[model samples]
Target: MEKKVFLLPFASVILLLHYWVTCLTLAVSLTNLSDEYALLALKAHITYDSQGILATNWSSTTSYCNWFGVSCNAHHGRLTALNLSNMGLEGTIPPQVSNLSFLASLDLSDNYFHASLPNEIGNCRQLRQLYFFNNELTGSIPQSLGNLSKLEESYLDSNHLTGDIPEEMSNLLSLKILSLFVNNLTGSIPSGIFNISSLQSISLSANDLYGNLPMDMCDRIPNLNGLYLSYNQLSGQIPTSLHNCAKLQLISLSYNEFIGSIPKGIGNLSELEVLYLGQKHLTGEIPEALFNISSLRIFDLPSNNLSGTLPSSMCCNLPSLEVISLSWNQLKGKIPSSLSHCQELRTLSLSFNQFTGSIPLGIGNLSKLEELYLGINNLTEYGSEGIVSTSDVYSNGIMLLEVFARKKPTDEMFVGDPTLKSWVESLASTVMEFVDTNLLDKEDEHFAIKENCVLCIMALALECTAESPEDRINMRDVVARLKKIRIKLLM
Candidate 1:
């Protein structure tokens, strides 16, 4: 019985020694693997010109595990993470990066890495966060990437990668953000991408993707918030199932070949801020419900077959609207006067439409209006008569001449002149006096004409008259004198 007890203690000691040796072997292997990857990176032309080689760093001498951008567990010294983002590293990612079998995160984004991603990346089975975006990596996505079961975010955007998306990517069930935009990727979007339940944002814009938008996309990923499928060849009616994306904030499907009226249910997206469905072939009246979206800041649906008068209550409810573009359509009827209430409006384009009648006088009330494009419309003798005065036109002409003289000049100063400057000034002052009392509340108009117009033209006429003592001064000569007068006024 005593001998049996002694054997049990001896066996336990042997097992403990075995475990210690196994751990030592693991630590040495990791150190060797780290050095191998560093060498491979250096040989592959990846460099830090500012700091020279990472292997040459003093910390690497003590142990390869102590290198910069490398972290290991305190007890085991197994590499757990490798981050080289924004390091200005160029050249292909070394396939030996897979040597770090225990790596849980690898970040190499925002670099100048070229060539295709190494297929050996799949060997990092424990990787949870892989950032390979914003690089010059080319070639198709490797199907081996599907082996990374723990990947949470895959950002491969803004590259020259071509060819179809690998179907194997659908296996990454933990993916939350998939951004492949601004690339040369062709072929229709892989249908399997919709199966990722954890996906919250998908940016696939600026690609060569062609085909109708998948109808069940939102149903597959109900948690999606931003869907950017713009600048593609997508056609056919917008899928009604998109309304299922209740949390969607930005939906951009612009520059597609989609036809048919916009889905009325789009108004259901209460959280939506930007809805860009423009440059399509959609026809029908602008949905009234669209204007009711209080959260909408930018609503663009231009270059379509939409017709009918704009709803008077459009901007009445949307107080936060900043940009509304509905130009190049078949819409008719007078523009709603209520649009003047949009105090936040910066750009309003309604050109190339069938609308008729005078523009509302209240349009001038828009204090925040910066650009107003009403050309190619039937707005003849609209409130424009009140908004634009003869003096305003003459002042604008002088300002234009000043700009032109600064840019270029022919031998004749008034090569483009067609009207008499003196006559124009007299007519402008008379018209200004007549409308100044009715239009302006402040006395600035009178002062402006007296100080700017009268002074400018009087000096100009003097210059012209001084050029030639006697002669029936031509309108062209008067214009040249006006230009000189403008220069004198500035001095």
Candidate 2:
């Protein structure tokens, strides 16, 4: 008919080019035998790899592309990566490792892998990183790993996981370090995973997560840097846009039950460094822009309900303060002789507070003060040393020797005695000659008292009856000169 109608359109264009090259050679031989039967179904469920190192080279006479945590791709040999980190590799994980469909990275971290997590690992689809941290895995998580879509770093931390947390991992969107912490996971953190903008670490600490905290924390993950919500049950407040993230650096929300305050612009971040909000129920007054965050280094807040008075210009912007636990709070004033300029302070807890005064003689210049807790406050000594004696129980040394021998401090049953430590060292050379008439008592009786506070209470009873205990005087330097003479008699 016209040469069979031009050879029937050239044999239907060579039969549609041999039917797409026989369907692309049967899809690259079923993707190289589906990566050797998905690494022989993860080495037949590896009952225990106890360093027989993948059971003596995962055999079949080798060449399953040279096995052992296989890593191929030498000019498209496929199976991209499988680290086997900390290789104490135990079992489980095998949903045939989703046939390692061109896996991009799968470091079985700190191995000991147990149950749940292999929802066929979303068939890998070129996964980018799924390190199962610490291991001993349990249920939840694995909503088909949000269909991967090239996932990027999802370390299932500590493991022993429980329910919730998988709001389909907010469809990945190329996630970045979403380490589900300690795990026993419960509800309420799925505010679409903090509106992931390629999250930069969102630990979700020791979970049991409760509500509140998604007021666009940090304008939607502006490259957030570590926000490990500590032992949870998280409550309201605290989300003052978390200081707009500004590349935050660790804000570990400790043992939560959170309540108001603490958000006084959290020092505007400035590349913060560890600001743990301990056992929360937070209240106000600690905001001196948090000591101007000079790249603070560990500023933990203890049992909260914080109060006022600590702002000595934030202790000279602490040159990298190191651990200042605001101990069991209800915190009151004066524990700040500008924290001795935070010379790398190391743990200073202000225990059970109501803090009255003195305890800061430039805290003997800190010298790396190691864990000091001013127990049940209303403090007295610490800074210039001498914590207590004269039978302490706030002994106030027999009421500072009856308020400096104005009478009856000369005990030992004084009848006509010059005893009480020789009548206070015979007035240590006339104790500044009674403050050389430094008067100023504009008061209408009721025991007026104010000749430089009776010459600093007779030079603090001759520096506590001197005669050497290093010449005494350290009831916090006489309560810091009676708090500068009671702030000049309350102005």
Candidate 3:
């Protein structure tokens, strides 16, 4: 019995020693991944305890799974993801992140992270989604990213990243969404980057990328739905091959150096809702096929050399259009009355053109219209007898009259002759009668004009008629009197 007791004690000692050795090994391995230099930089932005550790009560040695912004597999006790978005973290990405060999996702967006991406990131071979957008990150994209063969989505936009996009990224054959827009990237886009059959969305806008776009861009990426290449230096015509991209939903190639007539086959993109090709060198008449795209919601082609009359049946078929801008083009003809059928219209700008005829009365029926710009055009009003003249019922309202009078002298029909002093006396009597009867009633006793009201009114009348017969005060004298009275009471 004594021998058995000794063996039991000996076995307990051996087990305790084994446990200690295993714990020591784990601590040493974790120390290599701690990245002390980066940890110090992070500590500079945080308050630390007396032990020179971050001022947090969590135990880091027990299990990093319970650490902030970390998730792990319960069975394997391995870290799988780290989401530290919008955490206000300021510093360079630490190389120690390479220790998380099984990490599948990492999100550090909307923070102040700076400097080049750590080369050690290539160690996360299992990573699928990497988000580092909206940061102060600099330096060229690390070519080692090709190690992530399984990456599906990568967003590094809105950063200061410069130099050519690494050609090595073409290795990520499984990539679906890649957004590197709003960066300082230069050089021609890597050919065949879109050759990946799985690509669904790609946004490289607001960059300095030059050279013709890939001819097979749309054909190779069959699943691509959104492609934004605006604000670049890309030249050459839009590839006609893009018509094959049946699933394309949004395409913006605005503010580029592209030249050629817009492809008529654009109508083939039945799923397209937003198409912005404005501020490019594209010429020729807008394709009638474009008007037939029933799914179009935003069609912006402003500041182009497009000419010819707009198709009257344009908006007649597009009931989903909300914003349409064809301004600063050479388009002629009258505004389409059928545009009123677009009940969802919010903004319509067709300014700086040679369009003639009356403004469509149907335009007033567009209840959702908020902004309408028809300036610098030859739009004349039609009379009731179908004669082309400026005589519509709502033609000359107070606002329009003021704007016109400010620009040029008013006509005698609008403002009476001022050459004859007798004409002035007759105008003053008529104006006084209108004011006394309609304005100065007993109900207005509480709202009396100031003591200088009469002098101000007479001065205004004299100054208004001193120019010429066509510059005299007509019925505007009454409006002036009413306005002066309101101003005096407010003062």
TM-score of each: 0.72, 0.32, 0.70
Tens-place lDDT digits, model 1, residues 1-491: 35553345878999999999999898877676674465456445664433454536524346656667778777766778877788777778778877777888878788888998889988889988888888899999888889998888888898889998888998999988888988999888777788898999999988888887777778889898998888778787888777888898888887788888888778888888888777748988877888888888877777779988888778888888877777667988888888877888866767668888877777677788644556567866543646543222222343332222221111112124422343334454353332234333346645553356444554443343332224334446566766766675556
Error of 3 at 340 (Å): 0.5
Q: Of the candidates numbered 1 and 2, which has the greater lDDT value? A: 2
Superior candidate under lDDT, 1 versus 3: 3
Q: How far is 111's C-alpha from truth in model 1 (Å)?
A: 2.1
- Model 3 misplaced regions, further than 4 Å: 1-62, 382-491
What digit string (tens of lDDT, one per residue) describes model 2 on residues 411-469? 11332455444555566455433223224323536225444455555556556545445
The global C-alpha lDDT for each of the candidates, from Candidate 1 onward, is: 0.71, 0.73, 0.71
Error of 1 at 154 (Å): 1.2
lDDT of 3: 0.71
Give the number of the best model, judged by TM-score: 1
lDDT for each residue of candidate 3 in 398-447, tens digit (9 for 90 to 100)? 11222312211111122244322234335443333323343344455543
Candidate 1 lands at a TM-score of 0.72
